[model samples]
Each structure stands twice: as C-alpha cells, then as structure tokens.
Target: MSLSPSTLSPPPLSLYVHIPWCVRKCPYCDFNSHQGRGELPFAAYVDALLADLDLDLPLVWGRTVQTVFFGGGTPSLMPGELIDRFLQGASSRLRFAPGCEITLETNPGTVEHGSFKAYCDAGINRLSFGVQSFDDGCLQRLGRIHDSSEATAAIKLAQDAGFDNINLDLMYALPGQNLAMAESDLEQAFALQPTHMSHYQLTLEPNTVFAARPPSGLPDEDGSWDIQEHCQAMLADAGYRQYEVSAYARPGRECVHNLNYWKYGDYLGIGAGAHGKITSGHDQSILRRWKLKHPAAYLEAADSERGIGGDELIATERRPFEFMLNALRLVDGFSLTGFEASTGVPRSAIQAQLQEAVQKQWLLVDGDAVRPTALGRRFTNDVVELFLTG
Candidate 1:
C-alpha cells in the first residue's frame, strides 16, 4: 500500500564523497581503487564532484547536512588545498547544521604529522585512520604499506593537530594470527586512546587476490572465532562499547555519519564508484544512484548525471529487507516503531517473520526494541536469510 506523500516524514541529510585513487591497492581490498602514478588532478575532480552535486541538488534542497563522510579510495591522498576548496564549495551550496560531523578517512601510511594538521585546518574535524594491524608481520601479510610505528605516529600526529575525534580501524583473523597477536593489536590500538575504533574480522571477499588464491596460513573457523572473541573482550575492557558488530567507541563518540546510514537516512553520494540512496518527499519515492566506477573515465566524462551507471526506484516490498539489513547490525537494534517510521511502511509487514525470529531464539524480543542474540550475531547471514526468505 502506498502511504500519503504529504504525511511521510522527510529523511535526514548526509553526504558521502568518494575518492577513488590509492597509493597502492592492497592484496585483499576489493574496493574501487587503483594505484596512483603521479600528481592527482584534485582541482578537476573537485569540479566534477560539484557538477555531480549540482544534479543532486534538487533532491536535497532546503535540507541541512548533518554529516559528511569522505571515504576511500584513500581520501588521505587528496591534497589538503583541494579538500579545502571542495568543502568550501560544498558548504557554500548547501548549509551545514551547527556541529555537523565532517570525517575524512585516511590511511596511516599516507598521512604524516604535517598532513594531519593540514587536514584539520581544511575543516575535517574527524579522522578515521586505516591501521589494519599493529604487528609488523601481520601488516606485511596483509600487504599494508604502513608499519606499526607509522600508525602510532599518525595517531599522535592527529591528536597533536587538535583532533580529539579519531578512529582507528583494526582487523583480526589474519594469516598466522594467534590470540596473542590479536590481543596485542587491541592493546596498541587502545594505547592511542582513540574516541572510536572499528575492529573487523578479516573476510576473504570475492574477486580479491586473496580470495582468488586463498591466502596460506590463514586461521581456520575455530581459531578465527577465538581471536574475534578475545579481541572484543579486550576492546570492552578498554572502555570501548560495542555499538555495532565491528564498531566500538567511547561514550558519545560513535560515528554519526555511519549511524545515519544504519538508520536508513538519505544522502547525496559524489565521486567515482560512490553509491547513494535518497528519498524524495515530492513523490514519496526512494531512489538509489551510483556513479561511474573508474577514476580516469569519471574524470574524462562530460557530465556525471548521465555518467550515473546504476539507478533504481525501490519498491515498498524491498524496504523491509533493506531497513532490517542495516538496523540489525546494531547491538541495541531498533524498535518496531522505528522500522515503520524509517521506511514509511506498516509494522505488520514483517510481524510474522519477527515473531518467528524470536521463537527461534535468533532475536531478542525485549522492551521497546528487538536485537540479535549473540548466537544470531555469529550466524548473521542465516538470521538475515530468515527475514529474506520468510
């Protein structure tokens, strides 16, 4: 059933700016990134981004941006001068709410002490450092460029640059990784005292070099599970609260930009290979848009609006799967009313599946909200499947 367009609440405003070039592509990384050869045309790319934003303005007008995230392919590689120009142009076109969180993702290897200060001066208050591991051998096995010392220096530099809001990205379950290695990684990460941390279990995703020829000496299921549990315990002991499966943070330090996505908020995605979902109050319609993938092609292209490679107008039936897929990742999950409010669909649509999930002990039916049990989190794909195929 279609809800009345006038009665539906407007979605939150967020911006995701993608930078599609990296110093070098990691062996296990499948993200849309390529090796950078020489000087990058940052000004041209910024112009292209604004051009793309111009086309999306109609969908986001009169909405103040609450968060803006600059995600990979190594946003740290973007020259600080260019970032300042881009942010200035963006803010000039669209208003930013007071205290809006502006985050830039940086590879520890790419950022030095000076770069952190430059980034801060460019108006990026939050820095998410990609420091995958603290062990030298693990870093080598992961094909990461940065050594542990570099990572540590980068964190210290960010702090010195007046950035109190910082996040360290850590990965466990590496090839030949043991409990001691995992715990050490956590210890080193916490030593930085970052406001936020994302401890992810390494998965050999399809199409990556590691997946094609599965890395040797990798941990088995049981060993991986042990490492994961141990590291999570360490993070908890260090005062990091587990908000999502892989994300932990100090109190009030959760990534607001990511929260907008988990809450099914709308955002404008700009740059090569960036994907966006925007809901229109005009037609009560939800639209998904993705830009062209290649950096060279995206730059050479005349217009990015037509350069969009994928577009979809989501059907109401698919909203539950999309909404639940994101919300279920949270430790505290979402309320029944939240699901309805976010999707503008009735609560009854997934009632039978929700009841079955609780009955099967995969979901916790507590006051005001529903959350995945620890067992459910372990077998998350299966839990998601229950709703998908229910």
Candidate 2:
C-alpha cells in the first residue's frame, strides 16, 4: 500500500556530499573510503558531484535544504577552493535555508597550517574532527595516522579559525584500553571545550581488517560497559547532555544535520557511495537511492542513468522497522504523530510491538510520546527488534 500525498507532505531536507579518499584506511573502518593514490582527482570529482546533483534536482526542486554535510574519507583534504566551488555549484542549483548548518568532516592528520580557516571561510560553519583517541599508544594500535599531539593541535587550530561549533570524535574500548585510560581520554577531550562530542566504542565491523585478524587485549563486554558508564557520567557532569546513544552536546549545539537524519527527514546524497532518502510529492512514496561505490565507476557514470547504483520504493510493511531503526537511537524516543508522518505507517501497525515492548519493560508510552526506559536504552537492539516483522 502506498501513502497518500496528504499524509506525507515531506519533511525538512538536508544534503550530503561524500568525499571518498583518505590518506590511509583505518583497520576497523568499513566505510567506502579508498586510500589516496598519487594525487586526488579533485576537479573531476567536483564536476561529477555537481552533475550527480543535477540529475537528482528534480526530486527536490522546490525544497530548501536546511543543512549540508561534507562527510567521509576526510573532506578537509580537498583544497579550500574546490570546496568553495562545490558549495557554490550546489547553491546555484538548489535552495539553501537561511542559517543552514554546513559541516565538514576532517581528521587530525589532514590538518594543515591554514586549511581549517580556509574551509571556514568557504562557508563550512561546523567542523567534526576525527580524533579517535588521545592516547598515543591506542592511536598507534588503531592504525591512526595522527598521534595525540596532532589531535590536540587540530582542535586548537579549529578554534583559532573562529569555529565555535566544533565536534570532537573520540573512541573508547580500544585495544588494551582500561577504565582509567578511557577517563583520561574524555578528560583531555573536555579540556578542549568543544561544543559537541561523539564518543563511540570501537567495534570490529565485518569485512574490515581488524575483524579478520582481531587485535589483542580488546576489552570484553563487562569492561566495555564499565568504560562507557564512567565516561557517560563524566560527560554529564561537564554539562554535555547525552542526546543520542553516542552523541553528546551542550545546549543548542546538537548536530542539526544528524538530527534531521534521526528524525527520518529527507536528504539528497551525492558523490561516490552516498545514500539518500526522499519522500516523493507526486505519490508520497518513500524511496531510497544510492550512487556507485567506487570513485572511478561513479565518475564514469556521473552523468548517466547508471550514476544511481540502485533505487527502491520502501515497502509499506517495512516502513515501521526502518523508521524505528533511526528514531530509537535518540534518548527521548519519538512521538506517535511524528513517526506516522515520517514513515506513513499508522500507529496501529506497530501497536502490538509497542505493547510487547512496554510489557517487557523496554519502553514507556506516555500519551503521544513513546520513549525507551533506562533498561531499553541499554538493550536498544532488542527494543528496536520488537518492531521487526517476519
């Protein structure tokens, strides 16, 4: 069953531009990132991105993008001029809402003397630094190119560049990491005074090098849980609220682009290996699309119909599970009306699951809003699994 247009008037839109090159690939990273060969095809890639957006323009012609995120592989590695030109091209072709939160992801190793300032001047209002750990030993163990010093310097440089809205990415439960080490890492990160922090536990994802040859001294489940709990307490005491599972922010500093994503809003994805979701106005059908993964193949098909690797109409039966996959990540959960509007799946569709979850002490349903209880947040996977259908 398809959704009626009246019930799906569309949600706020965002834009994601993927840059698929990195100095070196991390052992645990499974993102679509290729190590830099001799020189990056900056000009060709930018042109291809614009062409890709042009092809997707019809799907979001009249909509104003509320946020733009330049993610992956280290977008800061690109020259500031190319970044500026790409944003200019996107602006010329699409409408950007006033005060749009434009973000760029970078790593500590990629920072040059003036690159941060250049990117800021190019209209990137927010910067997310990939500072996996502040421990030099852990950094080396993780195969990270940047050391603890570089990570510290990078945050200082971004602050000096006049970027107040900065996010530091830190990881816990690393190889040989103990509770004290985790606390020290968080202390170092907090000392830098970043507006937002994404504290993630390092897990060996499938198809990655680490998953094949696991590292030694990796923390067990109990150790990992201890590290997470202590660090979360430290963050809370320091005035950073845990808005999502791994994301913490000071008041009014939560990532707008990510919030839109967690809310199941619409976003246009361009560049190699980027994924996008759109709610079509014509029929109110929810569609998910993606581009070619390899840079060469993506560039070759940029202007062709094959530029899009695949597109599919999300089945109505699957919409509830899909929506909960993202929405349940939030600590506050979601409202029934918002969920219905975003997924076009009525409350009744998931009523049985909700009732079961509440009975299992995994969720608390208070009138219109349904949120995970403290126990539910701990076993979020189980809570979300309740919505799945056979």
Candidate 3:
C-alpha cells in the first residue's frame, strides 16, 4: 500500500470524556468501568481530567470542537455541581463550535429530578439513558440497576428538564428473551417518544462474568434474528430511521458525535481509558492514542509525561482496513473520494477488493458514491474483511 500526500482537508473534530466509575459493574460489561465503592473522588477526577486535556491541547490547538460526549460507567452518577464545573473548565480551555452538541450518558437509577435540570442548565443539550431492557426479569439477569418503571420516569424527567433531544439505549436478545418480550421492550421504548434510540444485541463479551459462566436461555441465532426483524419493523413504523447498525433516530436527530466517529473524523479523548484518533497535517499521517485504564493510575499520572497509556501512528498498509471498519457500518456507505481523502491511500490500492465486492453483489458503486447492499449490511464484517491484507 503506497501512501500519498493527502489533498483532502481534516475531518470534523469532537471531544470524548470518559467517566470510569459505575454504581455496579454489569456481568456482561467490558468497558473500562469499575464498581463504585464508598465516596467517589469527584473533585480529584475532574481536576485530573482538565489537566489531561491541557496536556493534549497542543495537538488540537485552534480547532473548534463540534461536539462533546460524556460517556462511561455512568456520567449521571457524578454530582450536578461537578458536571457543571467540568463543563465550565472545558469551555475555558477550548473553543466550541456554534451550537455544539454536548451529550451526557446517564442511568435511570441514578437520576434525580433536580439534577437533570442542573445538567441542562450547565450546557448539556443531549442525554442518553442506559435503559438496557424494560422487563424487570431481564433487567435482573443483565444486572442492571434500574427497572422498567424508573427508565420511563427518567425520560419524563429529562423532558421536564428542558431537554428535547434525548436518546434511550435499549438492548434485545437477553437471557430468556423471546419475540414477544423483545417487542414488548420496543413498545415501551417507543411509548416514551424519545427522539433517538440505540437498539443493541446483548453479546457475552470476553472477560465478562457472563462469558466466564455462560448464562442459560440466551436466544439462539434464529431466535435473535426473529427478534431483530420484528423490533426493526416496530421502530420503522414509529418513524425512527436506522442510521447506523444499532442507532435509530427521528429526522435530524442522529448523534453528531457518533456520526463523526463513523465518518472517520478526528477526536480528542480525555479521562481514564479514553481512546482518540487524530490526523496530522504536518505529515499526513493518522495517529491513535489512549489514556490509562484505571482511574487511580490515570489520576496519579495525569500531569506526568506518562499519562498516556500508549499511542501509535497507523501503518500505511493498515489504513484501508481501519477506514472501512468504521465507514462501512453506515447504511448509506461512503464515497470513493472520501475514502482516499480520509485514509490517505489511493483507490488503486483497494480497487481489487472493491471490484470483488461489487461482483458478489455486496456493494453498489455508482459513480463517486459506494454503498453497501442489503446483503452487505447484513454481513458487514465479511464485506469489511475484503479489504484486509492479512
């Protein structure tokens, strides 16, 4: 794979702040989140996060952040004052684009009536609730802290807090989940009238307790397919369009921060266990970086040179696979020119793979745009792998 000087401009820049503490670690969670114990070191963590951002300021100097996402163990668990302070600090340190979308990930069980309003007042325009399932039994099996009713109330509370752009995170194919149960969850979610929803399939990831001790009664492949088909229909009927594989939203309600990611844009990640991608104009090379995973460890070294866990300049040979890994997840796909612009690799490098995909009817390329077919979207991994060198 021969790399050439990129004539394309840099993509949009975003910010991702990770909060790595949760009330309780779920059995199937593989995120860099730890179970909360005793009082949280809220002030210390906030200070460390700001300092970490300071250390990374040079890489993104003068660049306006289009969006800011507070993701993690449960960002809503933090005190409202702390959230306000963090946002204030971030605003002071960086320039935000006009009407920049700021999102906070919260859990229903941790939300307080007054807190939601405070968060909104503090400049959070979007809220994503981690309401994994609506069924109490499924919630228990999944080790979620909130029940169905609390999830419902949380959305109402967010609405009352002046947040019109809200997203509900729901999951299907849980332990003992059938078609009816899946539909029931979707029905409850749709009833809330949320502007956006993230419907995900529950997978037992490696290193999770569920993977170690496999749970019984999980839906089989055929059963999971049935649940997905029916639930998708329900969402479409409710006017929620599927933008990404699992993300659905009403018109103009798609998550801007996530869209930047799927489009292979740039982001600066701060806080514990956060990952970031940046493209340098100096050499036209892309670099990936991450912070330390453990909160205590990250805090201890927040201002030190070793604060970063690791970073690497993406090898020229691997840019194609890396670009496709994210771009191909979009239903509308990407353009050939955009692909070369983002990866800094010529189209000739992957021409063979693109032709092969079209021959197999997995991709539809008409002129400058390249989109995945229905079959391609269904077996996205296979389509993406076509570009992999090894």
lDDT of 2 at 156: 92
Give one digit per residue, the lDDT tens place, for model 2 in 1-390.
Answer: 345346665889999999999999999999999999998999999999999999999999799999999998889889988999999999999999999999999898988758987898889999999998899999999999999999998889888988999999999999999999999999999999999999999989999999999999999999999999999999999999999999999999999999999889899999999999998767868989999999999999999879999999988778888888888889999999998888777787788999999999999999999988889989889988887876
- The CA root-mean-square deviation of candidate 3, after full C-alpha superposition on the true structure, stands at 0.9
1 versus 2: better TM-score goes to: 2
Can you write out model 1's per-residue Cα lDDT over 1-390, one digit (the tens) per residue? 455445345668899999999988898899999888888888889999988888788878899999999998899998888898999999999999899999999998898777777888889999999999999999998899899998999889889889999999998889888888888888888878899999998889899999898878888989998888888888888899999989999999999999889888888898998899988776777889988899888877626456686899987777778887888888888887777766777777677888888887889977668899988788777777766632
Clashes of 2: 0
Q: State which candidate, 1 or 2, has the greater lDDT.
A: 2
Model 3 residue 268 lDDT score: 95
lDDT of 1 at 29: 95
Model 1, position 49, has a per-residue lDDT of 90
**Model 1: residues >4 Å from true position, as ranges?**
1-7, 302-304
Q: Rank the candidates by lDDT, best first.
A: 2, 3, 1
Q: Distance (Å) between predicted and true CA of 355, model 1? A: 0.5
